[model samples]
Target: MRRFMKLSRKTLGLLIIVMMLLLSGGPGWARTLTVSQPNQQIYQEANFASTPLGAVPQGAKVNLIRQEGEWYKVDYQGTIGWLHRQAVPEAAPAKMDLSKMLFGGPVKETGSDEVALAGKGFTPEVEAGFRQKNPGLAYAQVDKVETFGVDQAQLQKFVSEGGLNP
Candidate 1:
């Protein structure tokens, strides 16, 4: 009886450890989404199970928080809603393209520079300055600029230029 009790306690402790391991450690299956269509309206609310919560033009980006069957739970404008999986790109945390999230619109030249040139027009000096600032930037003009993690000032400038707000 004493041996059996000791064995049972050991088994219980092992089981608990295994359960904790399974719950705490694993592949993070979170999905990050980028709006794949041009002029796609992301509604402020989820009108339907598949209706885009808001319009994310061509390159709007978001992070997937949950999955409801064929739809995705995404963070949009400080709110959550469902978007069709088809509208979002492949789910992977590694390839999250935040160019739009970083700069506002797509990673196009006009889009990226627009924020810096807002209320004004793009000029040679402006372009030169941007080039000087981001020497290694992929393009001379960018519709999007990904700051990788986050920068409030950069985000604010991007938002001021009508970039997607996080």
Candidate 2:
């Protein structure tokens, strides 16, 4: 207490600044980010077709080593991998403020509902009505087909081996 009181104002201010910098993860310090998705897939490379190196459950902390466009290179559970930007929240999204932005914030947010509906824009009411009208639509088969995906990494590997590169 005596030493702190004896310090000049300028010195105290400089000490405070240095402490702040240290706490703020200054240069060469690996910043950390949290996985926000229910499950986030980390790829070996940054692409839709890259091999999935592993997955991180929601709310997992990861050391963010670097970022490239829509992907972040992270250190997760003792492994280095690349995670999609959307799979993590850089920070919680800013709250919507009505009377300050166009259309007064959002009237409706699709959110995870969009994924479950497969982009068909189906509200629960709409889905229920559709089901009532089309009792034999085979929605299960449609959902299965919608989930199919072609691996792009495989195609890249194929091209490299077949001399298809220009």
Candidate of highest lDDT: 2
- What TM-score would candidate 1 get against the native? 0.38
After superposition, which runs of candidate 1 have C-alpha atoms over 4 Å from their true positions?
A: 17-26, 41-53, 89-166
lDDT by residue for model 1 (7-113), tens: 99999998986687567533343555778756455443444534455565567777666554445667766767766655653443222234553367664444444
Model 2, range 120-161, lDDT digits (tens) per residue? Answer: 445557898998999999988988998897677988888889
RMSD value for candidate 2: 11.5
For candidate 1, give the lDDT.
0.59
Q: Candidates' TM-scores? A: 0.38, 0.40
